[model samples]
Target: MASTLTDSLVGRLVDGRYKVDSRIARGGMATVYLATDRRLDRQVALKVMHAHLADGASGADFVSRFRREARAAARLTHPGLVAVFDQGVDGETSYLTMEYVDGTNLRRRLHEDGPFAVGEALQVVGEVLDALAAAHRQNLVHRDIKPENVLLSTDGRVKVADFGLARAVTEVTSTTTGTILGTVAYLGPELISTGACDTRTDVYAVGIMLFEMLTGRQPFVGETPIQVAFQHVNDDVPVPSTVVPWLPAEIDELVCALAARAPEDRPHDAPAALVHLRRVMALLPPDVLGRRADAPPPVVSFAQGTPDDTDAPSSVGEIDKIDEIRVGGDTDEADGPVRGAGATDHLTQALDTRASGSTIAFTLPDRDRLAPATGTAPAVSTSPTAPVDADRPGRDRRRPRRRTLVSVVSILLILGALGGGAFWWFGYGPGSFTSVPTGLAGSTLEDAEARLDAAALLHESVEAFHDTVPAGEVISTDPGDGERIPKDGTVELTVSSGIEHFVVPGGLVGASVGDARASLSSVGFTAVTESGEWNLDHPEGTVLGLSVVEGESLPHNTPVVLAVSKGPEPVVVPQVQSLTLDEATEQLEPWTLAPVVVEEYSETVPEGKVISQAPEQGSAALRGDEVTLKVSLGMPFVEVPDVLFTPVAEARTILEDAGFKVEVNYFMGFLGNEVRSQSEAPGTEVRKGSTITLDL
Candidate 1:
């Protein structure tokens, strides 16, 4: 399990786009956070490398390598592969935004549910191998292929993630830093011994993972990582059936062949491994396929014996001594023998000394000891002076010779029996079986029956509804296509009853409401119109969204709620004429209407008063509508002008020219030729266009 540093990055936004919501998980290299991609309005997983690893002198190199790996992973576009959206560096925080997976990884599943059934294990590994096949085809090798990297989504979708250790297949070494990469338990022999890696290395890791998934524990375990890694280089992976005796023999063979000590012994690539696995799966019976019980309890190696005399090596002291041979950078070399004469001599001496005591150790110096740890021939030295007393009597010497011969003959006989049993089980049993008919899916029932008859296999039809297959055509087979079945065995055929269910198509998010509804109806669904809300961003009649996401499968005639856009909501304009500017602005605030005040001189309205408004009042408008208000600034000031001695008509002309209304005050027909007095004093500042009375 990985631990997260208590860094306060939780509410911090990375690169100004990914707003970190909370921490998802922390691994040895990076910490993942659930974040929102503000630009795209979608959730993404933000993987931020530790600051210490991203900001030191060697940080640039690590960050650059991280970026390259991220780019490489982003190029792979398969449903089984987790999608990488974006990558960048923010200050000292180097991060990658990826598609957030909504399920636990295989490690969690294994811990909670124990080992998986043969069929389920094969399915999970098959999906992982399929994903690896895609990567291998692109010349990419996922260096780390462990259970922690395999995700089991909630919808029963298996996806492979964490391509952080992935590199191009052409790369000779795991890293330029000269440090061995990958978990020790899953590291391949070639990678551990020579520092050389390729597609087969990944295959070897998958094999180890398969073994663990089947046995509920890793194949190799030690007190230290170096001890486990040495096991990978020096020891062959044990057959799974040794631990889980109920497992099929074919499965054991497949796992052993995959986890072989030599690279040449494993599959060429993921595709080749997948082929072998599928064949193994096809040969399994229902007892093995459907066995859903927990794995048998782990066998303890050290109960009441010395460490070296146990069924398996129980002490790290002996294994750690093996690492001494490759110390001082010798492990980095790709050529020459890694084990020196001193190491072998030391191991031989230890075994001889231990055998001299009351305890009986199982250590052997022969290279044949590298055989699998299962029921293979046990290690027995043929040397005459191995652990015998030559000073005894001549009869004693003869008796020792006779005992050694009996032991050797007995071991040979056991080996022969084990070999013959394996041959019979695979050669004459399930391994020689015929595969079920191919192209049976979507084939007419009559055609499928003919094919099955030609193959000498029995058939039973099981009717089911298939969305894509036509009526009376075979949708699937019980044993599945390409599955191996014994001669004349029964294969269940499921024929389609036409498209009785509807599957929604993708890319319906931005489509128009009418087109989306019509598309749903065309696919045998009832498009129910749901009440729509006003969306300012989306255009009218455009689909705001749907009740369910696209690509969902539903029963026939199921009602799909369609949410259309009604555009922006309409607002009612409030009456604000003849009111003060402040009052008018207050009145329009509730309607979200903006008030624009334009000041002008007016004789009928007072200052700061709204004389009239655009679009009048009580008019319908959209929210955020702008309403222009014509406000009054009172009458303009003007001089009365010197017209005391002028005639009334002359004065009137002068007053009118100065933008003022003039009125004559004639008492009893007295026609005054000159204006004696004016209502407003001369040189006085009065309102422009104001009425002025003149005395005659």
Candidate 2:
């Protein structure tokens, strides 16, 4: 029940192989830890099912999924995949042991900062596709490929996490009726519409994550999880270029294709998608391969009237109070009885005052308690205490009965006079001069307010949050749309605040460890590293993976770490001399060697055999090296002279003496048939029996 680290079951070894070191992250169904592999002397990420999920009713399903995922993920041997080392139960706890990646999640990066640079965004997307390619090849779909489930190692390699785990969990709890597991923001359209998926589902998620990274916003949004899910099924994936304007056209097409509403429209699988992604990335200029140094810092414009000193907005839990006023007087009965005009405002003000300065719960070093606000109260606040004036009746005491009756009669007489004034005001006064507009259409609150304000009417933005209305869109108007009201009367509006923003995970694909750290610091993410992969393009010491996708909704200050990648491995080209061409090609295959051959005459070497090589035996070369070989053509031979520059009588006599072939050319007397030019000079050495080219 306790969310604090001291009370949680952290620092305990599970299955005697993994020693729980610290909490890395937590979600609705599980808590993940950065643990050490005692036997292997390596670190790993251990995800333990939540106690509620490990209950007898769901335990079988959880265990089955844990095992199924191990089987499926283990089949995938790729640099982009997060390896599954082990999965088992330690007493009552069920956990999965995977390669511990050390890096921030993409979600934390976006939350700490705003948007990712175009280069960094592309890198993340491309790496994720690389990982997905491996999974899809194995016929395994990572049903949950959100930013939270994609981890970046310290070396900037992307390792996909939670492959098939969500589907396994779903299969485990078929009886229980509740929302299926997975973040709403990154769910693929097919998953939302049909509950059917393949590797393309993950591609869709990768597209969504890329969109968020580039634009610092999700493509689809709603007030409720259901509405957001519906948006996936019905709405087109909004282009991030529309939001950022600087995104490249190729990238825009790639993203749009990945998130197509219909599955048939998306890439066939992750591998195919990766091919497209790589092709698109290859087309980008070299300068776009890394973070752009010239990009100006994003303009920091806080909403008008927002406090100057408030900490940057964090996750949903960090937000203290939200006030959503109903527009107009069309208060629905379902909203409960309406309070007096000033009463509602007073309550909101009180909550706002308390929330204004409250401290947010942050992550810590303990495993099992890595997430902030794991549905528990803060440790610092004390229990409520009774006030000292509890028993006093000073205000409740009434005057004498005769005085009360006289006061009631006098109030009645005054109310009658006010009733007459209200009737006149409604029937004949200027209050009847104007009518409220019927609809705001699709106008943003800012535009609506400006238009209404210019019309000399009062405009008040109601801070109501709805599941359907986009942020800053007017939900409704005051006095009801189309209702008649007095000129200069207030036109109240219920504007959306949009879905609550959360910390972006640090380990986005392609981000370096330092970049991840900067991003987390900016967004307020605090998760610790657990494991990682080694990649060359990203280099070692950069973030390579994350538990969540970027821009996912999660608790604040989750402890995330940068999983660094090990740069590409350098291999020496193998020796291919003295071997047959086939044998040599096979031996050098591992070195990525390219073989080129040139035929030359050698005194001692046999024909069709290798004589010498440019890079001889033991000569070092990198993979993909081109090596030239000299093949033997045996000893050189020459033919006798074939002269053609002599006169017919002189040529025939010379040919017989030199043992050469000669042909005579006849010409008119003006152009004498004398020796003009010879194809080959006399006595010159030439290959045996080769025809001599002649010209007259």
Candidate 3:
């Protein structure tokens, strides 16, 4: 597995979140890749199922099951467990995401350095049990437990990996089918005999792992995995002290107690076993806890690195196929394990299938061939060596490649079609967008809507006034006409309700001229002309009316003329000359004129008549002006004094000067100017023209 351009999925984005960077390891079921989580911006271990499993007839069911299992693993949150973050299927690629531990796993540590001292082994086992305890509390079982699954982080934390992935493969592995699922080395007896699983099954695997840690070797061994699996059912894991003579008896008892053949014989679960192991740790002497029980194994390094770093199988022949022993196969290692199965490698393994009183083997990629110590060791790691292409676990090197001319041509054609469809669907099809219809600014609403509908665009109509556009015609579009819009997106259509017009309100007559003008202006009549007109009916300063008729609808700013009242017309003097006082008073009533009478004498006119008026006839006068009239009185009387003895001419002169004519009368019809005797008594009051007679 070299880093190259042809390394499938090495540069691919899985489910749009994880970007596969490099191949880490591969197993019977899937391949583990070191990838970056594009969304979270962190490194992760991406385990993608092999193409065979994902593209098989039961691929859908397998992926569905895998998603469910991954979800279950993701729910378990503990510091000691490698956190499962997400799981999804992108096309045929079904994958799971887990936290990347920088340091190697326990198997690598044991390979680099031999068996751990009592304290170190207890520490590793303690962390494993802690993680298992949490899972078991939630009724979850780790079907595969081995050094490969126990990861040691560079920051000094021990974590258990692969929580609920095994169960997902129980019925999907092509080789194993419905049989066993985990490695053979750590399969519980119950898993081999009867497919019944519980927390106790994991406890059994942990015990076996404990035994291997103390003695630097597994409790059982054989030429084939069948022999090793049968040993767990028929034989008891010997006390670790048998191999490591200096190992404590309590540690031996801890191993034997957890690895019991019967489910009930083992501590009920990882919790009980954890409690028991802790008790043993408390009882063990400090000196014993600090020193290794066995000599260190020679350090071995390879250019291809350990099974954890490469696609190679474990050097100790840790790969185990459960269905081979169950279904009776000569070759082909099954990736699934019996419910509680631990094999040589880690990271990738079979699903857990429960069998009773029987141990099943599942091979996993062992990523933990790290350097271990009892009390203290370097808790850091250098970069892994590059992988080599070779006969590796879980992969069939004999699988033929299909690259015929016809197949290549067919694939090219299919890709071309797919590309074209994608382009149209996201570019010009319903998935993309379109422009609003052009020339819709003044188009009818019905026409604009029809065009929008043809363009596959929705529309909304709004009414507004337009100066140029006609009524019911489109004024403008929200994105403007011809602007881009989504194919199914709504366009705001502004329809013209016609030019804005207002009506001058009625009832403005008799109102204040200013108020009337304001009322007219309120309805858009800004231009106004005002004038004062005398109105008898309306009061002064009130509106006589307007030049423009009220209640007439006109365009905005139409001019209006307001008629303001100055009052009634000025009164004219009446011609009451020679009229009586009553007649004059009656004739002046219309003018509201007051008649002021002054008695005046008229020589030839009768008395008590209006001789003349002060404001003469037909003259303009105030409404309350008075007209002075003079009434006629009788003429003055003259007295005749010794006119008979005076000269005749002198008598005539005297009479004429008195405003009277003197008539002379003889004894018989004499005509003389002299007055001998007056016609009437001279002492009487007579008119000035009284006749006077004189004797000659």
Candidate 4:
């Protein structure tokens, strides 16, 4: 994905420090870009306000608010809050560098996955409320609280963002007469009615967001901005359980209370709302918190308009309608201020009316105002021909007055009793409770139990495995720390057993013996080193095998045997020289050695006699090493040359050259030494240096 920078600012460096990478997203007030902070070598989100929004219509007012976002965010330091790093302007571009959260916004998440589970919705809203509480403590009001401003990281972290509409509680007004800000759907009644915002306003927005998370949609829907704003002013936020029947009654109450039309009826601030939310969450059962297989269908409502919708209505009739319905009024003032046509004209008129000391009369309907007047009597007419009640008497009037007084007294006594009962049921009954002690986690079980006992709270112990908590220490409390619970209510304390079991790490398979032992010890296993069989496949000191297979879970501190490699096994060469070929081959086979036979003629050794081996007897060698064997053949043989029918001298020379003894046989005296017949016949084979007789 690319950063949401405009084409001109895409590759441009802002303030000569942040290198713009790509555009991330664009909003009405600013375009956020993914950028690299060259000076710090970290990724940051650079929010550059729109040129016109920064220095145009609203001018300094808008810029001042833009700057306030940076200041407000910078002052806050919470994990749930995005960090502001730097703020500056390059030419006409006003930008702020902030922590870049690598995750999708809640709006996107809701769009992709629909509504969240009961627990998940509460957790997300709780985290946002926590952030808001922090801002409220600092006297800052996050006027604009919507799903788009809530970010959910891939690592399961939730952060609240976009303080663009944030303003100090001390500020006289959020904007000038012509300007009205905030999303219409999340706007509180006071904000839409009188343009007055405070911490309660943020609480209202969070409540609306919580409803959307649980039910998958906002409560109010209308065709136009005025209609929705009118609903915010007049209608009560519907209970989530109405749409999601399975939703807990507690959640419905929390949402409705936070989003109350009257500010005073709502929680005093975000912290107060958060406390109520935590209490509601703590009281919920596991089944309610768990994911539902049959999730509720998405609630399709009217699409919300842009941020400028706060100024949508431009007529006195619309204002009167909103006001009359809001305050239960009926009379219409003919001299109401006439509004102009513009984006903020309606807002200006509303604020101007208040500024001009002309208050818009808010009169409740007759029925809703008070009980009907009583104790009145019919008067007798004193005109000619006028009818008079002759039966009417002073006694009758006195009797009627007495009866009215008695009825009033009776009604007051009944109302008092009912109000007291209601107060006891809601305030001092089982619902009334105090939060658990803080820092209960990580305390010794005995100490935690003692504290709970002192608080007159009953508790049960439960064992669970924790990665960081030590054995016998409290991992967590069921109601969790700082959650309100009924007096003497049972709380479950989960104590850590110190990693009861773990699977053998697969990484130890080919690791060194030392590394394997270390890994085993790290996982609460005792490693016993043992010498393994000699193997050529693995290097010495390397892990050959384990007694237990990888991924097999075992009890803590179990003794595990580690087999270390000793390399290839050595073999001693046996005596094979001076032995027969068959015997030598058999002798080498026992030692796992291969023997190569070479035959050669020898002067003393008999044919097929014992041979000599290359690797002498008793030589150390590895298994499968080759050994050479030299076998004895007889003396070299050559063919005798034929000297028949030749002269004696020539024959003798030839016989002598052939290295054969010449023997002439004189048959018939004086015959030339012509070898007519030879002891070795032609083409006959004989041993070299063997005596051969020549007959003549």
Best by lDDT: 1
In candidate 1, what are the lDDT values of residues 100-163, reduced to their tens digit? 7777677667766888988899899998888887677668888767666788877888888877
lDDT of 3 by residue, 182-232 (tens): 666777776655455677788998998888787777778654444565577
Top-scoring candidate (TM-score):
1
Superposed by TM-score, candidate 2 places the C-alpha of residue 507 at a distance from the truth, in angstroms, of 32
Rank list by lDDT = 1, 4, 3, 2
| Total backbone clashes of candidate 2, pairs 3 or more residues apart or in separate chains | 76
Q: TM-score of every model?
A: 0.52, 0.41, 0.44, 0.47
lDDT of each: 0.71, 0.58, 0.67, 0.69
Model 3 earns a TM-score of 0.44
Q: Which stretches of candidate 2 lie over 4 Å from their true place?
A: 1-4, 164-181, 286-696
lDDT of 3: 0.67
**Candidate 3 residue 269 C-alpha distance from true site, Å:** 0.7
RMSD (Å) per prediction: 14.3, 24.4, 41.7, 20.8
Judging by TM-score, tell me the better candidate of 2 and 3: 3
